[model samples]
Target: MVSVALAKPLDPCESPAPFSLLVPVYRGDSAHRVRRAIDSNTHEQTRPPAQVVIVRDGPVPQEITDELDRISAASAVPVVRVELEHNAGLTNALNTGLLWCSHDVVARADADDISYPDRFERQLPLIEAGADLVGASMHEIGDDETTPLALRQAPVGRSEIARVAKRRNPISHPSVVFRRSAVEAVGGYEHVPMAEDYWLWARMLHAGADVRNVSEPLVGYRVSAGSYERRGGPRVFLAEMALQWKLRRLGYVGFIQWATNVIVRGGYRFVPLKARETAYRFMVGHRNS
Candidate 1:
């Protein structure tokens, strides 16, 4: 007979570490998905967040606003809403949300994704263990959340993560829980089009931030044919080129690395849709195996 080991239950006497949840929502998000995302992280999780900060990047529809109100009233913990008059884009919205977070440790969640009940139960201890930034692998799922597509794995350990970041993003942004002080110390997130999170991770790595990634999947990331289609096109390729240039100027990557990354990762943005999806699936299978 073969035995499979399971994670032990958290001690009841030892209260979970306190951390704030930051979720930024925009006009395009669905009200139902937003509510589900917040509920999963707050009321449904084994370890609920101390506070939840929902940043309204711009004015959403009345239904979405009402949902936010209901979320605040029904939440077990404090929920703060930071409203911006105009759509300031993701980088601005994220920076704005960071200011309102009350705890030193902040966990990020997307408005459309669902977090596993033990997500924080698995991640918070790493933050308590002195890691400046911690992220986890995620299971890419369809809209229903039942259909699994691929496993996106993040590199583990400080040295390995740093080496990988020189060419590609090493952490899953939505599955991350990072120290507020550490992020602010590196000047917070900057404008990098679709690559803001990657840029921030690169900057943090260059600054010697202690980073780690849980090998197991903790978040259910939503993916679709539309998601794959959006990955390509001239605009996204330009964004990729801009990020590679930024990394080179920051001295985070050597000239050869920068050029190679530009050719490979940047060229990926121009691949045919079917080919791109197949390549992604192949990479996912190769890594998860």
Candidate 2:
């Protein structure tokens, strides 16, 4: 969905709008996946990111170190690695990378997720059209895209995004390209665990950013049926509840919205894995099934 605000003709820019991609990695198991993710961005796109910043969350295994080394050694575009002394989480890693990035626009790539070659190309226009933040739908794949799970959908347009923001995240975290100044204006990313993206989106929206989503799937989001189960637990629920109250304090959530978020999301955390699978399909987004 094009932002209705940008429905008018797209005036060509004097020069290309350059952007950069950022990926955060922790360990060896993710190295191969990270390579594929980077390949999708650089190998065939008409307009690839100017830089790919991979932040080493901590001391990764030698295999991961080797893989990053080899890729950086051969890439045509800059594949810069920022190594951390110890394991800081995703939020910190991203925050670190953001400070190192050069462009005003930044796209995030999960080390384990795959991007379509044109993902960056497709997102630049929305940002150029005054979107501070833009994301798109993704094919939620477990093993492969064939017979996959769901197409994770995000709300489109500013008003719809604000309405959905009161209850849940209206943007896909990994599949986002946001204006650096807009994000920094809202305090960059907080150190919120499990729900950093949710917290950041709410805060950014409250700070009056124009957020929108394209309707098409541009990313292959890796989603095992059991992922919802593993990614949810007592700690995650606690973090989520904390986030609810945080949003409430930020005026992005009301008392009822906060309570409902705590109850509904916390309850979902306790369901069996099979039931969690169904909840993942139902709650995550619109279903083509």
Best by lDDT: 1
> Which pairs, if any, clash in model 2?
none
Query: lDDT for each of the candidates?
Result: 0.86, 0.80
lDDT comparing candidate 1 with the true structure? 0.86
lDDT by residue (1-289, candidate 2, tens digit) is 1112222223685565778889899974467777777787776566788898989998988888898898899998887889999887888999999998988889988887787777877888888877888899888776664554668887777788888888887888879998888888778899877879988888777766778888888888886545766756788778777888888787777888888988887787788777877776677685863
In angstroms, the error of model 2 at 175 is 0.3
Off by over 4 Å in 2: 1-11, 145-147, 286-289
How far is 61's C-alpha from truth in model 1 (Å)? 1.3
After superposition on all CA atoms, what RMSD does each candidate show versus the true structure?
A: 6.8, 3.8
For candidate 1, write residues 1-289 as lDDT tens digits. Answer: 1111222334657666689999999999999999989988998999989999999999899999999999988888999999999999999999999999998889999999999999999998887767788899898887777765678877787788888888688888999998888888788899998999999888887877778899888999887669878989999999999999999998899999999999888888889999887775554432432
lDDT: worst 10-residue window of model 2: 1-10
Candidate 1, RMSD to the unseen true structure: 6.8
Count of clashing residue pairs in every prediction = 0, 0
